[model samples]
Target: MNKMVKGRIYTLIGAIGWGLSGACGQYLMNDSAVSPIYLTALRMIIAGVFLTILAFFKQPEQFKTLISTPKEMFQILYFGIFGLMLCQLTYLIAIHDSNAGTATVLQYTCPILIVIYVSLKEKTAPTVMEFAAIFFALVGTFVIATHGNPFNLSLTPAGLFWGIISAFTYALYTLLPGKLIYRWGSLIVTGLGLLSGGILFYIGSASWQYTIQWKPYTFIAFIGIIGIGTIFAYTLYLEGVSLIGPVQGSLLASAEPISSVFFSIILLGEVFQGIDIVGIVLILIAVYLITMKEQLQEKHMRIKH
Candidate 1:
């Protein structure tokens, strides 16, 4: 297969993995006995360990280079704490407060946030398509939150708040690691970041104190969260981005919300109103528009050249 086809497949697999992880997170959280903090800590640690080992085997020199300098160490630590830790924590909290589908949709605002940040950094106005995308994102979010009723909210305030925060942190995650990723390779950087973040989470949460009843499903869920969700998902998604560029990769990742909503409705029996579905569709369209705009701009530049 061509790189584009492989990239799309990888992107789709990554999206499905994340979508499944969100739903599984909700499932685990519903157990009442499972603490979200503890779960997040454990998941990060397990995935970090796995990835670190993989990175060491795959690219030992790059892994060594990543940790060689204090500046690089600090960068990895910062990326871990702010980028990986906060992003995952807020996302899990959002899922705990609301359904997986809603949480995923809210996190879709990251693209919009990225656009805004780039505009501010570059001191340029957004393109017309970008403006339209922003409008659609806002209106879609409003629809999802309010469910077409101005007075009442479909999602809890905490859910909405955390979800937005998740998106913001995700945007930071995307932007903060570009230099390190370029220099040290994405696998090494991500592995180290996850490991550092996981250590911090362990210290902060004192996760060892959390007690849990051992169930088969609990173990399975933990494995799924760590292995498929974090390790495979991040690895595959980054590979896809490298192969096809971020715009097409992101467009393919729209499958995340679709998978999340589908699994939530099917596996968890979550119900969505017509308005909610419409809201989800609009948000997805907004994401597509934003990504497509970039694709078009790239094409136009190529044509001009």
Candidate 2:
């Protein structure tokens, strides 16, 4: 396949992988005695080790650059703390405080945050379509959070807080790594960031006396699947971003919640009402609008020029 086809395939795989993460988390929470915090922490650590080893072997030169530059070192540390650690901690906290579906929907707010961040950075106003997309996404989030009941705001305040924070952290995560990837390549930067995050999680686990159980193929497989799956997803995601630009990449990634919804229905037996379906449709339309803004704007500019 050509680069475009390859990029789309990668994007789809990444979306599916990310959507499965919630199911995996819920499975671990239900089937095992692991706390979300401990599980997330372990995930960070183990994935870090796995990726670190891979990076060392495959991209030795990039690894050397990472070790050589103080700025690059700081990038790893920053991403580790903010991107990996904060993202996992808050996201898991959201899941614990609320249902996985609710947390997942709230996390989708990251795209809105990303649009705002980019708009601010560029000192340019967002197009009307972008605003419409943000509005649709916000509406979808509200519907999902309320479970279509407008009066049920008291279900999970803590979960909502953490979920919102997780969204912001994710926005930063999306924005921060582009420059680093340009400088050091995806493998080295991602590997180091994972290592730093894992170390921090290890410290947290140590403090809490979180013991790892070595029984049950389910638990063992869960860890490996989540870790390796994420690595594959991230690798593809970075490549897609590089090929297609972040705006299009993020729009493609917004399909993640669709996958999550499908998995939730199949695996967890969660059913969507008519209202929920409508909300999801709106969200999809909104994402399309937001992503197409640049193309639309470029067309208008060409007409004017």
Candidate 3:
């Protein structure tokens, strides 16, 4: 198989892993006694340990170098707490408040936030397509939130709030790691970030004080979230991105929400309102458009060089 083909497979599967993680969260919430915050801390610690150990073996030099530098250590720690930790926790909270399908789709707003941030930072206007994307994204968000009813809001307030915040954090997660990931690789950076986030959140939230219900199926879901979801998902996705580039990898990553929705419909017996489907389509289009912009820029850079 071609390397690019392998990358696509890896990316698709990785994204699906993420989507499944959301469904697992919803299941655990419905079936078990653990809180979202507690789950987040546990996931961070377990996944962090596994990933860091992998990093020490696979990327020992890079890992050692990253840890030795104070500035890099600070940046990775901040990225862990603010980026990965917050993003995961908020998305889970959104799942708890709404459903996995809704939360996953809502988080797609990250691209719009990223476009706006970059435009502002560069002091340049977004392309016509970008403006269209922004319009689509906002409209999609509104449609989902209100079920297209202008008169009343349909979704729970907590769901909407956490979903939106998750988008912002997702954007931050995307933007903050470029330098660190490029220098030390995703394995080291993300491993350290996960551990840092786990430690900080563990101490701050006192998640250790809570008792978790350890059932058979619940244990399966927990392992699914940490093993197949966090560790494998992050590793495979990052590896795919390195091989195929971020633009293609990101486009492929749209699979996450699709799988989330599918899992919700099939496993949870959740029904999607027609308006919700329309809104999801629009949000997906918005993401597609933004990706087109990145594709064009990459092409332009290649041709110029």
In model 1, which regions exceed 4 Å deviation? 213-216
Tens digits of per-residue lDDT, candidate 2, 81-122, equal: 778777877776776676556566677778678888888989
Q: Give the top-scoring candidate (TM-score).
A: 3
| Prediction-by-prediction clash tally | 0, 0, 0
Candidate 1 per-residue C-alpha lDDT over 1-305 given as tens digits, one digit per residue, 9 for 90 to 100: 99989988998899888898888788888753677788888887888888888889999887787677889989998998889888888999999999899999999989999999999999999999999999999999999999888899889999999999999999988889989988888878888888888999899889999887666587677656677878899889878878988778888899999999998998789999999999999899899999999899889999999
- Ordered from best to worst TM-score, the candidate numbers read 3, 1, 2
Deviating ranges (above 4 Å) for candidate 3: 214-216
TM-score of 3: 0.97
Q: Model 3 clash pairs?
A: none
Cα RMSD to the true fold for all candidates: 1.6, 3.2, 1.2
lDDT of 1 at 178: 89
Candidate 1 backbone collisions, by pair: none
lDDT of 3 by residue, 1-305 (tens): 89999999999999999998898888887778779999898888888998899899997887788788999899999899889998889999999999999999999989999989999999999899999999999999999999877778788999999899889989888888889888888888888899998999999999978876777789888877888888899889988888899899999999999899998998778899889999999999999999988999999999999
> TM-score of each candidate?
0.95, 0.85, 0.97
